[model samples]
Each structure stands twice: as C-alpha cells, then as structure tokens.
Target: MAGRAIVVTSGKGGVGKTTTTANVGTGLALAGRKVVLVDADIGLRNLDVVMGLENRIVYDLVEVIEGHCELRKALIRHKQLDNLYLLPTAQTREKDAVTPEQMRDLVAELREEFDYVLIDSPAGIEHGFRNAIAGATEALIVTTPEVTAVRDADRVIGMLEAYDVKDPGLIINRIRPDMVRRGDMLDIDDVIDILRIDLVGIVPDDQDIIVATNRGEPIVLDQRTRAGQAYQNIARRIEGEEVPFRELAESSFVNRLRRLVGIGNKRRKAN
Candidate 1:
C-alpha cells in the first residue's frame, strides 16, 4: 500500500511548524517506519539543519524535481536513524522554482518507498504554502495559544477546506500552563472553540527545545522533555495507536489554590 503524505503547516510564522515537522518525522522513524522529511520551504530551507544532515546534502528537492539528480541522490539519511531521511530544498531557488504539479508528483513517488512523507511548509498563505500542500493527503496545522496564531490558523483551515483538504488536524504548540491559569493566555478549550478542529497533539513550552535545535538535534530523541514526549505521542497517533494525551504542567499557584479550596486531591484530565 502507498504511504501517507502529511503536510506540516502553519499560516503564521514562528509557531514551531518546522520544529514540529522535524520531531514528528523523527518520532515516526523511531517507531520503525520508513519516513522522509521533505523541506517544501524552497528558498528558506531549515529542515536539513534541524535533522542534523545539512552537511550531507549533496542535492535537494529542486534538483530532484528538475532532474538534476535522482531522488535517492538528493535524500540525506539521518545519522542516528537508518529509516529516517531528509529531502532538503534548494536555498537558491524561489518557491516558483517547483510547481505544484511537480510537488504532487514528487510526493507520489516518495509514497512508494517510505511509509510516511512529512512536508514542512513555509509560513504564509501564498505560493509557497500552495506548493507545500499540493501533494498532501493529510495536514497538521500548528498554532500557538496566542490570539494572532489562532486567528491565522483559522484562516488556513478555511483555505484548506476550499482546496478539498478537509479535516486537517490541529497541533497546539508552546502552551504555558501558568499563563493559562492566570488568564493571561488562551487555554486549550479557548483555542479549540475558535478553530473547531480535531486536536492531534499539545506541546508544552519547553526550553530544551531551543537547546536541542541549536545542537542540530530533534527534541523527540531526548526522551526526557515533555515536548519530545508530545511529539512522540503525535507519531503514535499517526500510526493508528490510541495513545492518551498527557497533562501539561500545572502552576504552583494552582496547587496552592486547590489546597486553599480543599480540593487538592481532585484530578482534571487533559482536553
């Protein structure tokens, strides 16, 4: 059977879309699935660096699409995971360099060899975004708990619907429990109310993500970080496993409040 082609996209920038792609792809590979990470952000590619295979990129997506090199020649195998590979994009080419039809065809080809093909989309609603989702059979929309990010995600959801890519799942990233408890940020329920999509994964605000990125390591490989576990859960869910979502960190203030209210033993489930 052909594999799945999922585009990891966020309409707004700086919402951990690329990071989510890297970690989830890595997580899927760790699950023993043959996976490929396609950097669809042509002119501003970063998936290779995030996968720690930037030095091994001899060819790129454009080169493969344009017939400059074979598909296997452009794929950079991950150092740690033999089943994980990355198809980097050409930094010198524009989004227009690869047409939507070309992307669709490329994804179809990848599906024949890999169990999963995760495309990292550029941040926008323009040509780059169009090219990114061209071949996607499914989509994961990444958004932070901020108002602007949620609003942009809503817009992207509508656009995806128009393009016949229905039921795109949502991945809420960088949620701070302290802020939510203080009413200084949007809660999970608030974001879900606004977007009204299926929730795939919820990643907590973890500092280790930055440290891992700087070292060219995907956070999913760490095993100790909450964000890494969240990504792994996403991968498991993708594999048709029923993994329960984990509770995010609760603020000390909430604990104190629960003690003061004499309900400290009460438990609440993750939304």
Candidate 2:
C-alpha cells in the first residue's frame, strides 16, 4: 500500500521547520516504518546537514527529477536508522529547478516504497514552498510563540487550505514554559485561538537542539529532552494514536492539581 506524504512547512524562517522535520522523520523511522525526508529547499538546502547525511549526498532531488540519477541513488540513508533516508536538495540550484507537478510526481514514486515521506519545505509561501506542498497529503505548520511568527503561520495555514490541504495541524515550536507562565510569550491557548487549527505538538525550547543540529543528529535520539518527546508524540499522532496533548508534559500533573483544588484563584473567605 502507498504511504502518507507529509510536508513540514512555515511561512516565516527560523521557526524550527527543518528541526521538526528531522526529528519527526527520525521518530517515525524509530517506529520501524520506512521513511524518507525530502528537502525541497533547493539553493538553501540544509536537510542533509540536519540529518547528518550531507557527506552521503552524492545525488539530490533535482538529480532524480531531472533524470540525472535514479531515485535510489539520490536517497541517503540515515547512519543510525536503517529505515530512514533523506532525499536532499541542490545547494547550487534555484527553487525553480523543480516545479509542483515534478515534485508531486517524485513524491508519488516515493510513496510506492516508503511508509512515510516527509518533505521539509523552504520558509515562506513562494515557489519553493509551493513545490514543497505539491505532493503532500498532510501538513505540519511550525511556529514560535512570537507575534510575527504566529501571523506568518496563520497566512501559511490559509495558503495551505487554498491549495486544498485541509486541516493542517499546528506544531508550536520553541515553546518556553517560563515565558508562558509569565505572560511574556503567547501561550498555547492564545496561539490556538488565532490559528484555530488542530494542535499536533508543542516542542519545548531546548539548547540541546542546537548541539544536536551541530552534530548532525536528530534530537529524537536524545530521549532526555522535552523536544524529543514532542516529536515522538507527533509521530504517534501521525499513526492515528490518541495521545493526549497536555499529558506529554510533567506540568500537566501540577495543572490538574491546581484545577482540582481551585488553588489558582484567590480565597473568598475574607470577603
């Protein structure tokens, strides 16, 4: 049977779209599914770098689309996971090097073999982004808690809808519990109020993500980080699992206790 082709995208840059893609792809692969991470970023290609497969990229998506190399030659397998592979993009070519129809065709071919195909789209709603979502059956829009990123993500969500990609779930990246507790950043409710989309995952802000990126390793391998657990949750959600959203965090226990006793409110006995 053909598998799902999901695109991970964002309207603005630096919202951890690539990071989400890498970790989620690895998470699904760890579930024993055959997976492919396709980098549609073209000239700004970095998915290979993120996947730690840059040196293995003798061929890329462009080569496969243009017939310069066979599809198998373009797929660079992950070092740790035998089931995970990456179809990198060309660093020298422009986004126009591949069109929407071409991308759709390429993903169609990939679905025949892999159980999951995850495309890491370039930031923004331009040609690169269009090509990235061309073949996607589902989408994960990543954003930070900042206002600008949220606004841009809202726009991207609408664009995805216009493209007939319905119900693209939201993955709020880089969420700081401290900031949210202090009202310094948009909380989950605030973002969901504006976006009004199904929540997929909330990746906590973690410095380990940077270290893992520098090492070209997906954070999912390091089970200690909340971000890693977030990606794992996303992978399970993708597989039709009913994992509760807030239950992923330890704070859920505290929040539930607070709710149970109404401790969050001031006492009214003195009134």
Candidate 3:
C-alpha cells in the first residue's frame, strides 16, 4: 500500500504541534517505517532544529520548489535512523514562497518513496497552515487542555471540515492529572465533549520534554520519558494498532488503595 500523509497542526501557538510532529516522525521511523518530516513553517522553521538536522540543511523546501535544487538534494537523512529524513524549510523565505499547489506536488513525489510523510504545520489558519494541510491525507490536531487551546482547536477542526480533510484525529498534549483531580483543569472527557473527534493520544506534562527539545533531540529518543512513551503510543495508534490510552492519574498509594477497594466492592456486587 502507498504511504499516508498526515499534517500535525494546531490553531494556537506553543501547543506542541512541532514537538508532536518531531516525536511522531521519530517514533514511526523507529518502527521501521520510512518517514519524511516536512517543515512547512518556511521562514519560522524549527523542525530541523528539533530533529538536530539544522546544520546539514543545504537545500530547503523552497529551493526544491523553485527548481534551484533537486528533491533528493534537499532531503537530509537522520544521523542515527536510516528510515528517517527531513525536508527542512528555508528560514530566508516567507510563507508565500511556496503555494499550496507546489506543496501538493512535493508531497505527491514524497508519497512514492516514503511510508509516511509527516508535515509539521505552523500554527493558525493562515497561508502557511494551508500549504501544510493542502496535500495531507489526514490531520493530527494537537491541543492542550486549556480553554484557549481547546477553543482554537475547535476552530481549526471546523476549518478542516470545511476543507474536507479526512479522519482528523485529536492529540491532547501536556495534560496534568493532579489539576484534573483537583478540578483545576479540563480533563480528557471535557476536551472530548468539545472537540468530538477520534482520540489519538494523551501526553502528560513532563520535564524531560523540555530538556529534549533544548538539546535538539525529540523526546521519543529517550525511552524512559513518559512523554516519549506517549508519542510512541501515538505512532502505534497511527499504524492502526488498538493500543489503550495511558493512565494519567497520580500514582499515590492512597489512589491504589482506593482502586483495590473499588475492585473488591465490584466483585461483591457481581456475586
């Protein structure tokens, strides 16, 4: 079967669209799939830096689109993973440098060679965002549990529906279980009630994600990180595996005791 093209997007900034893209691409590649992560932000490009391929970018997407370089010349292979590649964006060029038609063509060409093409979309429903979603077979909407992020995600979902994008899934990032338990934050049910999309993954807020990003490495590379495990789960879910959602509750002993008591009560009720 031909590879699938997916766009990782969010309507609001700092909601982890780029981070999700980097980790998902890395996870998929680690699964033995040939994946190409395209940075669609153009002048505001950061996926290259997140993937640690910034210094090796000789020809960017704009250069390939404008015929200044061949497509093969623009792709930078990952240092450790042979299946992973990055098509970096030109920081010198603006969003208008490449049109939606050009992006479609570029993705079509990539589809022939890659098992997955993950587009890292820039935030907002603007020209850059349009170019990113133009050729996507599906979209993965990334959002936080905050009201502002959920509201923006709803707006982006509406726009994608208007554009007729298929099977757009939701990834709720940086969810705090303690806040949810304390009624201080929006929980998963609350987010699902508002968005009304198939849930792809839930990533808890983790400090390692920050350190990994700062070190120009995707969190998925660190197998011990909870956030990295979440990303891997998402990649597996994307591959059509029926992986269950991770338990995002606090690991207090009292919480475990309560669970045990609840199970005992349930057994008695069954009897």
Which digits, one per residue and each the tens of the lDDT, describe model 2 over residues 1-271?
Answer: 9989999998999999899999999999887889999999999988888888888879888989999999998888888788899999999999999999999999999999999999999998999999999999999999999999999999999999999999998899988887788889899999999999999888888787999899998888765555666788889998889888852356645645764676543321111
TM, every model: 0.91, 0.91, 0.91
Q: Model 2's lDDT to the true fold?
A: 0.87
lDDT winner between candidates 2 and 3: 3
Alpha-carbon runs more than 4 Å astray in model 1? 249-271
Q: What's the lDDT of the predicted structure labeled candidate 3?
A: 0.89
How high is the CA lDDT of each candidate model? 0.89, 0.87, 0.89
Count of backbone clashes for each model?
0, 0, 0
Q: What lDDT does candidate 3 reach at residue 81? A: 84
Candidate 1 C-alpha lDDT tens digits along 158-235: 999988788998899999987888999999889999899988989988888999899999988875556777898999
* Candidate 3 lDDT, 85-194, residue by residue in tens: 99999998899999999999999999999999999999889999999999898999999999999999999999888888966999999998889989999999999999
**Model 3 bad stretches (over 4 Å):** 247-271
Candidate 2 segments exceeding 4 Å error: 251-271
Q: Candidate 2, residue 93: CA error in Å?
A: 0.4
